[model samples]
Structures are given as structure tokens and as C-alpha cells.
Target: MSEILLYDIPRKDPENGPWSPNTLKARLALNLKGLPFKTVWVEYPDIPSECKKIGAPPTSTEADGTPRYTLPVIYDPSTKKAIADSYAIAEYLDATYPTDRQIIPAGTEGLHAAFNKAFMDSVYFPCMFTIGPLSVSALNPPSERYFRTIRGDLLALVDSVRPEERWRKVQAAFEVVNGWYEKADNGKVLLMGDTPAWADIVVAALLVCARNLLGRESPEWKAVSEWHGGRWAKLVAALEGKVLYPGYGWTKQGGQS
Candidate 1:
């Protein structure tokens, strides 16, 4: 078994955003695939140093030399391979491990590929567009003072978008996700079938982020919202803390706390 090291920020507060989803997805995938790995929780503004030490790129670096970032950059110590990006990391695990307990389906690569792309467009992007701005705006003046100096670019990126438009886009995306989930599940418990698949993991991560961060009440996404709050809860709870590969723990605990 290969040793895996996941680089992510510790979930100190509940509203941390991207890092939570990134870590959650990686942990779930590892559990679903039955891989074992160690988690290395780094703080915001120091992640770049941690990344460099582990042979990974710094996603963000401050002028004062800090590296707060996202992505559970997976380092396979045995092979000296480091991978970043959530979907890429998941795909790598699925292909390399290839188990009967596969996270993404074996024969349905096309479907998974489409789902992955759609997720980025529909769920991930829009949700970030909405929450990122709100989160920054809501930060206390002193806290904002610290973050603004280091992450001013990110703050500016979200501030450029109109809040109304961001909300509308997020709503539209959730509706699309809900529709897709309804069609895929066909009133079943899981997204694809009785068993949870890679598609489930992808959507589950999206719903978790949306509901937790973007406000759970959406008239347009009622069904999807309900399903996510209900059915998906059971799935994640059942798989909590199960390791899927070396050094990676597939546990929901990383995000919830």
C-alpha cells in the first residue's frame, strides 16, 4: 500500500468554505475506495511552505510569506507523486486503485466525466460566486483587515460580481443539480443505484457545501434540497471515518468539526 499525505487547512470554524469541501471529498473518496492515508492540517497563511515541503505548488502566497489555500493535494510518498484539484485527485484514486468498491462507476466513465464537468460549472462555480462574497463582506473589520491585506485579490474577485446576480446563478445551478439528482436517483436512495457511486460523492460534496454555506432554503431547488438534507445525510453518516487508501481517511469528521 502506498502512503498518502493530504494537505488541507484545519476546519477551525464552520464557515471556512472550499477547503472543507476539498477535504471532505478526498476523505470520502478514500473511504469509499478503502485506501489509507494521513491528514496534514495546515493553517491559513502557512500552507505554501507546507506545500513546498511536500513537493506541491502553493495555491496562494501572501506578501509577508503566508500560504493559505485549498485542495487536498495528495502526496503519494511511495511513488513521489503529488496531485492537486479535487476532481483530478478523485479520478486519480479511482483509476489507480480500481476496486469493486469503486467510487466512480467502471463502465460509466462517460457519465462520470460529464457529471464532473457539470458539477464544476453548475454547483461549484456558482456556489463559490455567491458565498465567497458574502463571507468576505460579513467578516469583522479587524479580521477583514488581516485577510484583506493578504487575500485582497480574492476579495476583489468576489466583490466584482453583483450579489443579486451571484444569488441568481447559484439558484439556477442548484435547480440543475436537483433535476439531475432526481433523474439519476429515480426516487431511489442513492444517486445512481442502491450503492453510492462517484457521482454520489461529487453531488454530495456540492450539496453539503451549498446547504451549509449558501442557505438551505431555495424554492427552485426544493426537491434537491430536501433530498440532500435527508437521503445524503444517511449515506455520509454511514461511511464516516472509513479509510479507503494509505494515509487518507475517508471521514466526514474533518469538515463537520
Candidate 2:
């Protein structure tokens, strides 16, 4: 058994599971590859301190030299290494585990990086602005006040916009993702044929968060879930029980599937 530690943020229902896309992506990779890990629940405010304790480098340093930290870090006890960031962690896992199922895929790191960037910018960027409020609202209650005091203020401001128009922007982004899936899928529902790839995990992480964070009751959730003929629905179903995340298994019935 490999000793692995995953550091992630708390979902609104921490007792249930995680809701961070980056962390969720890391978890998905680990689960699909049959790697077992224990999760270290890190609150928003403790990121810097938690990261420092593990000797993980900060995301950046301020002019005055303050260390800034981020989430989705993994510590491998066997190798005695702590890696930060989703992309770096995925690559590290691929190298360490050397499984037949490769998320980054052999000899395609650069291509996958570019593809992930495209999804981040085109699909996730606009969705960020549109779903910003819902995302924060899904944070554990303790962090909600803290988040609202910082970036949440900006995200909530966007919520005041007309819901229909706000949804329009998000819809356009989903269409782009759907377009890519149409190209990628041959006779299966996954991105790279029958097998689930890292790219699938990358995209699924966001949708999973969206479904779990916003909750099915919210209009934002409805619009996102319905977009592209609920294309995400099928992918969500395929990967649902394979991993344990806040929104890993959901349905319109208002119950965990």
C-alpha cells in the first residue's frame, strides 16, 4: 500500500466530501489509478501554514516576501516528497505510479497542458465570473465569511446581474466544451476513447464542483446541468461512484445517487 496524503479544502458539507475542482481533479486521478490516499482537510485560511509545515513552496511571494499558498497538494510518504498544484501533482503521480492508465499520457504532456489551458480559459474563465457566487456559497460555513471578506466580494457582485444574461455567458462556455467532446468521442463517452483520461478528469472536476456547490435547486445549477443536452450528465454518471467527492453522485431527485 502506498502512503499518500492529499490536502484539500472543505465542502459545505465537509463530512460528505470535497468541492474544490483542482483537488477534485487530483482525487479523481488517484481514485481511477487505484491509488489510496488519506485526505488532510485544510481550511481556506490555513493554506499558507499547512503548506509551510510540509515544506511545500508557496504559489508566489509578495514584494515584502510573504508566501502565498494554494490547494491540491499531495505528499507521498514512500518517496518523502510533497508536490503542489494540480498539474504538477498529476505529472508526479504519472511518474511515481507508472500505471497503464496515464492521465498526462506518455509523450503528450505539452499537448495536454495546452488543452487544459484552453479549457481553463475558454470554458472555466467565463464560468468563473458567472458562478463565482455559487462557488463561494458552497464553501464550509466557517470559510464563507472569510472568503466573502476577500475574493467572494467580487464574485457576489456578479450575482446581482440579471440571471438570464448571466446564464447566457456560462452557456456559451459550456458549448465550447461540448464542441470539443463531440470531436474527441469516437464511439464512447470519454475524451480519449473508451478509457477515462486526465483530460476527462480535468473537465469533470469543474462540473462536479458546479453540481455539488450550487446544488440542484439553484437556477445556476439548472442551467449548467442542462447545457449541451446535459452532456456532462453522462460523464458524471460514468465517474460518479468511482470517486468520493461532494457532488460525485447527484440526481434531480434531491438525493445523493
Candidate 3:
């Protein structure tokens, strides 16, 4: 099979590669499927142009109603098709590849959809203040400049909060998420019990993002590792062998496009 090109926003750390949660979702999906691919690092400013060059559709609209192009676009050279959006990418891979251990799996779409929304609300947004600033520091110079320009208000908002308050909210957010996990059968590490699925990929991406942005030794990350009775720590550990870092399953290619 011809290599599927994965468009990812590169960070300064080449060894760790991409750090954004959403892009990691797509990358993790491809890794889980054992697909052959190469990472084409697209800087923040280049995402719109690169996506347009490949005809990857805009995933959303900006506040002013202009189309917004995002990263984590996969261009399958074999099929000559470009797909955008992480969850959509998962669905596409499951449909096109049809592995026995499918990402979406049959009859779980609605459940997964509900969990996605709940996870975003309960955990993702609330934890942003804690993790958001760290993301800026992780970016390459060009992407950092572009990110500051567009996300100034958000970064400022993150800075305005007291560190104590920010951490309190983060812990609270995870507490809510912990409740959801508790509803699963006893000792279930993943959302789908022993089986990993798209939901597991999503949560794992968040944990990986946290670990990277916060630094593994940082107190924030340490606290998270111990949260919910060490639930997240175990989840990350379980996925350590599955989630491929750079130079493992895929090669990083040069050039913006």
C-alpha cells in the first residue's frame, strides 16, 4: 500500500513529535490500525494552505463565519482521498480497513458519541487553563507566533486565573469524569472494558497531551496520575506499548506540504 500522508502540527520536540490532543487522536488511530504512514509537519499558518492543496475539507467555521482548516488530515495516496477530523478519521479507518478490533465497533456509535461529548464537557474544557499555556511553550517558533496571534485572549484568560483555582477546577473536572468511569464494570480501565475503542483513544490522547505539556515530573501531571485511584496512570501505562511515538511506526518527512 502507498503511504498515507498524515498532516500534523509539529512541536519543537521532534523526538516526541506532535502534541496537540486532536491530532494525536488521528495519529493514535493510524498507529492502532498498524497503517503505513508518514508525518508531514505543517506549521500553524500553513495548515489552511496545505489542507486546501490536498482538498481536505474545512472541519469547522471561525467566529466570523469563515471556514476553519485544522490539522490531523490524512491523505491516502492509494485511494487519492483526503479526510479531516479525528473522529471522522477513526470512522473512515474502521470502514476502509475493517479490522476485527474496530475503532468505532458495531452498535456503539451512539454510546461513543455521547461519551465524547461528556468527556469534552466534563474534562477537556475545564482542564484547558491548566494545560493550555504549556501547549504554547511546546510549539515551534513559527507556530508559537501564529498561535499567540490567534489565541492571545485564551492564553491571557489562562494566565489570569490563580494557579490554585486552576488546579482546583482541573481536579473537579476529573472527578466528574471519574464518575463516568465508575459506572463501567468493576476494574475496567478503558471505556469499553477490556477492549480498546475510539473513546479510549480520545481519553488516552488527553492523558498523553497532559503528560507532555505538563512534563512527566511536573506536580500537575503527578497529581493527575494519582487521580481517581490511579485510574489515568494505569490507562496511560496500558497504552504505552500501543501508542507509537515518532520514529517508531511512522517516519517523519520533510517539507510543509
For TM-score, candidate 1 versus 3, the one ahead is 3
Candidate 2, residue 82: how far the Cα is off, in Å: 0.9
Query: What TM-scores do the predictions have?
Result: 0.70, 0.85, 0.92
Q: Model 1: residues >4 Å from true position, as ranges? A: 14-19, 57-70, 133-147, 160-165, 212-257
The sequence of per-residue lDDT tens digits that candidate 2 reaches over residues 32-83 is 7677676777778888888889888777665578776888898888888989
Provide the clashing-pair count of each candidate structure. 17, 0, 0
Q: What is the C-alpha lDDT of each candidate?
A: 0.63, 0.74, 0.83
Q: Which ten residues in a row have the lowest lDDT in candidate 2?
A: 248-257
lDDT at residue 30 of model 1 (Cα atoms) = 67
lDDT of 3 by residue, 63-172 (tens): 89999999889999888899999988998898988888888879998988898898888788877778878888888899999999997988888888898998899888
Model 3: weakest 10-residue lDDT segment is 248-257
Which prediction has more favorable lDDT, 1 or 3? 3
Candidate 3 global TM-score: 0.92
Candidate 2 residue pairs in clash (backbone atoms < 3 Å) = none
- Model 3: lDDT of residue 3: 83
* Per-residue lDDT of candidate 1, residues 1-257 (tens digit): 86577775554344443335666687667667666677776555565566677676655665677654455788887678777776677888877878776777777778888888888877887777765554444444554455678678877787798887877787677667767766754576467767777677766665555444544465423444455456555544433323222333423444323
Off by over 4 Å in 3: 16-18, 245-257
